[model samples]
Target chain A: MKVIEPHIHMIARTTHDYERMARMHTVACCEPAFWAGYDRTSARAFHDYFTHISQFEPKRAAQYHIQHYCWICINPKEANDLSLSREVISFIPEFLAAPTALGIGEIGLNLNTKNEMTIFEEQVELAVKYDQLIWIHTPHLKDKLKGTKMMLDYLKGHGKIKPERICFDHCEEHTIKMIRDAGFWAAMTIYPVTKNSPARVVDAIEIYGIDHMLVDASGDWGPSDPGTLHDAIFEMRKRGHKEPVIETVFYNNPCYFLGQCEKFRLTPDRPREEAWA
Target chain B: MNSFNKQAALTPPKNASELLDIYFLDIRSALLESAAALDRIERAAGGKDILDDPRIQDLKRACNIIMDGKNNRSEQILLLLSHPLE
Candidate 1:
């Protein structure tokens, strides 16, 4: 079955990870701008980061027959530096036009700080202006619930924001309900350490069902592995989920969201409503 | 469709006895890796009592959840280890 990894940091990974993903039938992967294990010094650094993901990563993934797509934004972790963020956001529009660039993404609060929210709001405006799809990164661990709520409430009240066009990733059991209930997509990220495991992700799928759900490995520089996504697929198989159900979560759901951008090429095998049925 | 109206489309999984037949080796490998890690931790502690450490306590709690035979063991163990408020 074909898989679509909707959230990962490929700049921090090597070609071997790409090869592994290709072998596992990952037809396409999306890399949202993320923390590169440390804070970058200036907007110029973010420019280079954005350029690499947009200009370079696509070529790298094409060698393995995997379509590479990216999102542009000043990530939440670095959003605290307002001057640097403004500088980064200033150039985001140019990259947003790139063929592989999906939209403003992985953009949300890092610490639920006022500065982060301000930048997040600014980026939301940017996305709306450009008619781009959005991908979000909710804060980790203890701050997640409040951080998710904070973004949800803001977007819900924004009047112009369309929940269907946005995705809030790294959702857990506690946060999944609110995200889905709000008509936004909820993505569970599997990690080898320090986040949702494959089993836990599968459990959420079992409990919450698969509508508007996405699963990603979130492989990065930290202790994470791309295989976690395949592990979740395997977990579902072992639990006796039908192939169509697995396809809906791991493949079709991502296509439905990311495909909102004309740049994303994959189409769902079945209509979303039929898959849900 | 929302969580309230949809459920995972799944048939019952293989019985535990049948599952063991297919996954025995994988289970054994995981247990062996855990045991090896615990052995290394104990040796590195140099006889100092670190059993009461919070990390170890969490591991123990996780193990208890594993043995509880609940269908949602993964969710229970994850909640025990996660920082999110349940």
Candidate 2:
């Protein structure tokens, strides 16, 4: 069961996590540029963070026989600082040219604030201009429904950013329908303490049917555990979902969505026998 | 504890309704514990650091969701458990 972790903060994780993920059959993983647990003081900070994820992290993951990819952005949490964000966004294209750079993401609202939305829209335009994939982080808890609605309305109204090229992540039972109905890809993140659990994610898949759906760990500086993803896989198998169904949701779905970027080399139908060879 | 391994070996629920009920209970319990932990951390940190801490921000978000009465998963769960394929 080869997997592609569509969203994770690999820079915050140790190399041992990579070893575990590889053992669990994770062929690849993506690190989206996000808030580094603190507000960085300057664009130079983001420059270094991007470089670490893009350059250093891949080398680290490769040592475990896992290919690492990443998304670049100011991240919604830091996008509130307009001046700092502008400085950071100005140089994002330089990192985008890197081989492992996939698209602009984990870039949506934090507090659902006006500035966050402003930066989010600008980044969407940036993605559009550069013809890049967009991965979004919707607000959590009470704000999730409203924030996701706001993003959907904003993206739909813009009318130019293709829905298929964008994925709204951290979707829950409340928000998945609207996201899928609106024709955009939807992803659910599994967490150890705070967010969706494995069984709940399986419930979402069972109900919604995995068309454009994806599941990831969203593992980061918090108490998240990457193992929750495999737990979901195990949960699905326990629920009698066939191997093909599990493969589609965990492997094929991410490949289908992320493969829109030419840099993502794996495909849903690729011969598994040749994976290690 | 090896409780996860034990739980993994448990039999699958007979139907979507049963599955939904189990998942809702599990998720509810996890969220409640997370909320309680966050409350303790907030009290110890004295409210000031919550504004700057991203982990605290996530904790606050999760806590807010758990506290919201209107954010119940029962309706969605019911719909899924009932239709199972809509």
Candidate 3:
């Protein structure tokens, strides 16, 4: 099945990983700027990182026949350093002009600290000002529920933001309902080790009808495998889900969400008989 | 950088060994990045609490394995590179 990986850190991945993903039928992937497994010291570092992902990574992915897209932001993990965060935020708009750039993303609370909240709001404002799509990264494990609620409350109170234009990623069982109920998009990120597994992701799909929901592998520096996404697809198929349903979750859902930015090229496939004509 | 251009297609690897080479190269690079991140974190934190963290230990162990370059697959790659079949 054709897939669009809605959240992955391609900067941390290799070209062979792109090849493997292409072999798995990943037609497109989105890389959201995230913590480099550690904090970056300067805005220049972020600038170079952004350039690599926005310019270089797409070319790399293209070599493997995969269309690469990315999001830019001072990720929440580093947002605590307000000075550096502001410095990095200042130049993000310049990168936003890059063609492959999707929006300001993976931008939300890490420790749920006040500084993280401040930068998150500022980046949200930046997204609003530019009329860009948003991709949020909720905190992990224990902080997730509270952080997701905090983000929801902030977005609700913001008054200008549209629910459909934003996606709260890394959602779990405890957090998915609230995110979906509020009319915003929700994404579940499966991993090789910790966090949600393929079966759990399919379970979420069964529990919550696929409306504005998406699933991704969140391949990164940690113990994540991009193949886990296909494993989830296989699990869904094994559980008797129809091809169309699988296609919708894997392909069409991403198209529907990322299509909001006009730069996304792929269209959802029509039924077979219509295509043959 | 402002303009997006299509990249030229790359030929896929012909054999399983070539594919394994590509995969190992990526794994090594990723491990190096992880090692560098750990180093930065340790340095920033003055090597106090950072080294003690279990997560940091796990990353360090992964990095050591890849960097040693003496394992079965990596060693084979090294041998092939150092003594090419002419």
Candidate 4:
């Protein structure tokens, strides 16, 4: 039942949710760089927002006994506002040393915005400078396919950037293989309306094997959950997945990514419960 | 809770997918109360701190609204996270 949720946004989550996940045996969380845009206005506004993600959110998650670490980046949808993007970027370095601040992430393109590309590139450079991992976000709508390819194109040419130090998010049927082939971890966000489901996530693991697969709820401003990661694992078990394979996808792969954190702790193996045992 | 919204007799949440729309808005309401209590404490402590007192005022104005909004949204998230969209 051990798990490591790779893309939860604790800023939108409550402490009770964290306690439930911790007691359910969640080991760690690798939150991607995300926007708390429910009401954020300017770059100065997002400056405080990033600090909350890097500082307050993890502290709250810890109170529930779960290790919560996050990536820092301005999302592509906000790229059109260069002022906010620039301000958020400047604030990222200050959060690098926080025990739970994993990397520069959740950065990528939307609708082929040249402005988004610029923001993504600058953040990527920041990621490289701090020697932290990159958490990339592919577009979620009609332009996703094109945006995915463009994001990969940008990463491919960087001489000092290794593809292995990255996690590509919002991956679906179309983008999964491409991101995997490029040597990045694939994180499937399980949302009811837009992203993959608990069932689909399990199916993806069945097809991809446990090498570098991770799942999360992407619990942002949308209808999402901080506990869905655990629910996905349970659904996988009910669907006939072996406990060993389930544990690896839920715990092992996510920990592998968040292990990049300076404060990572070793996860221990536990026996799975059987109905008749 | 009404019958349509109340799945009180429904099967237990065997998985995340099963918990959708079946709220413990009951739980959300309770948590919101405690969060409100904390805000009152913060405002009390910070009395007259900004622009003669704007920071404290903003904190108070923000308190009740954020509590209600977060709880309502938490329910939406609980449903969305548990189930998959076609």
Candidate 5:
């Protein structure tokens, strides 16, 4: 069972996460570009972080025999600090050219504030300008509903972007259908407290169907289970979702999504190193 | 600087938040510039009295889009990117 975690930030994660994830047949993983625990106040700092996540991690994952790809974008949460954000933005090109680099990701509103709104729009514009796919991160506050609507409206109005080319992440009960109906790729983060749990994700598939949908435990910072993709897949099967559907969300859907990014490749023809294990 | 460039930096800034204070700050300038365009239009075209009018509304609409990021992931990243509570 080859599973693809379309979103995960392994830099803030521990080595144990890789061990656990590698054991589960995680064929490929996408880490949305985000702030690590460390604070970076300069372009030089961003250069280092980019290399760590976009370069070092992929090599590290190769050791574990898992394909690692990462997204490039500032998260919605950090929009207020206008200074460093610009420097970070300047460094994105260095990573985008990397073979393991995907697209601008995990970009969306968080608190739904003025800063968040500004950065999200610019990032969407960047993705469009680069002809890159997006992986968005919705809010965690009550404003999530507001953020979700704001994100969808902004994307549709951009005139250069297609919803199919962007993914809305951390979708909730109130906003999931609207995300799908708007014609964008829809995703849910399976963390313990925020977003959907595996059980809830299973229910989401029951309603939203498997097309253009992907799920993962995009946990970074708070208490989270990096193995949530495995949990969701196994639990969905236990919950009576057809085995094939479970496989589709866990494997096929993500492969299809990453395929949109020329940087990511999940070939079904060859046997992966893990397949031998 | 320009609306297109303001739109340009979002992807890279968010991808490398902790180290990119300059990126967000730069975006802030672009956003405020758009906001200035709206402010100017609001003034030249009359106050909020006629604000609902469509012509000035176009600039304001573009301003609103960039302002929206003040509430997004990059904003939250600032929280993480900021000085620790300690």
Candidate 6:
């Protein structure tokens, strides 16, 4: 089946990885702007990073025949610096106009700190002002539940925020039900270590059922692999999940969500279901 | 197949069987490493009653969770090993 890797860092991946994704039938992948494994020193550094992902990375992925899309934002990890964060946010509109750009995202809290929340709210305002889609990064491990709840409350209370147009990534068992119940998309990221394994992801599918659910291999700088997405497909197969159910999780679900943006061109095979049946 | 209708799409480079064949050695190596680590821990303990150690107990619990017939062993073990929400 044609798979859409809903969240990955293509800028952190190599052409060989792109080749593997193409061979595995990954037609499109979205890269939300994230930390570069180090603290970037200035807004100019973020300019270069966004430029590379929006312009240079798409050409690179085209060599392997995969569509590379991205979201532009001041990621949560570096949002602690107020001056630097505002400066970065000022130029986000220009990048958002890029054909590869999806929306302002991966832009939630890293530490659930006051500064991170402020910047996240500002970015949310920016997204709503422009009528753009949102992709969020909930904090890892111990901080995840609180951080997720924090964002959910803010978005739910916001007058203009539409839950269907937004997604929260790095979701685990404890936080997914709240996200889905609130009408937002919940994405389970498969990592080599320290995140949901392939078996766990499939088990979540079996429990949750796939409506607005998405699965991605967060192929980033840490100990992660792009093949984990395919491993999830295999996990579902081993458990006797039919091909349509597997297709719905890896392919159609992402299309239904990402295709909300005009820049994303992949189409879902089935009609969009507003609520999980 | 319910709502899906893509019957002529491109297949993955490696099907499920091919993937299992390719990764069998990797899985075996991981199991071996876990076994070796447990053996080293037991040897270092020198037959002391380490069963009461919380870490050992958790590991034992994790093993049982994995052996159970139910799916979601990973989630069960993760929640088991995780510190309670503070």
Name the candidate that leads on TM-score: 1
Q: Which 10 consecutive positions of candidate 3 chain A have the poorest summed lDDT?
A: A268-277
Number of the top DockQ candidate: 1
**Pairs of residues at least 3 apart in sequence or in different chains that clash in candidate 4:** A192-B85, A224-B77, B50-B53
State each model's CA lDDT, in order. Answer: 0.86, 0.81, 0.81, 0.69, 0.70, 0.85
Per residue, candidate 1 scores C-alpha lDDT tens digits across A1-277 of: 9999998899889999999999999999999998887899878888899999998999999999999999999999999989999999999999999999999998998888999999999999999999999999998866777788889989999999888899999988768888888888889999765568887788688777788889998988889988889999999888777888888889998998888888889999998778877
lDDT of 5 by residue, A1-277 (tens): 7888888888877777787888999878888887666555666766777788888889877877889998887766667777667666766766788888888877787677787788777777777777888888887745677777777887777777777678888876567767777777778888885567776676566655666677888868778877878888776655444555566668877766678777677853322222111
Clashes of 3: 0
A124, model 4: CA deviation in Å?
0.8
Stretch of 10 with least lDDT, candidate 4 chain A = A268-277
DockQ of 5: 0.01
Candidate 5 — which residues are off by over 4 angstroms? A268-277, B1-86
TM-score computed on alpha carbons, candidate 1: 0.84
Best by lDDT: 1
Model 6 CA lDDT for position B59: 81
Residue A219 displacement (Å), model 3 = 0.6
Better structure of 2 and 4 per lDDT: 2
Give Cα distance to truth, residue A46, candidate 2, Å.
0.5
Q: Chain A of candidate 6: what's the TM-score?
A: 0.98
lDDT of 2 by residue, A151-266 (tens): 89999999687888899999877778788777888899997644687877887776777677899999987998788889999988777777776887789878878898999988
lDDT of 6 by residue, A164-258 (tens): 89999998987887888888889999986667899778767767777778999889878898899999998877656678768888888888889
Native interface contact recovery, all models = 0.27, 0.06, 0.00, 0.00, 0.00, 0.02
The residue pairs found clashing in candidate 3 are none
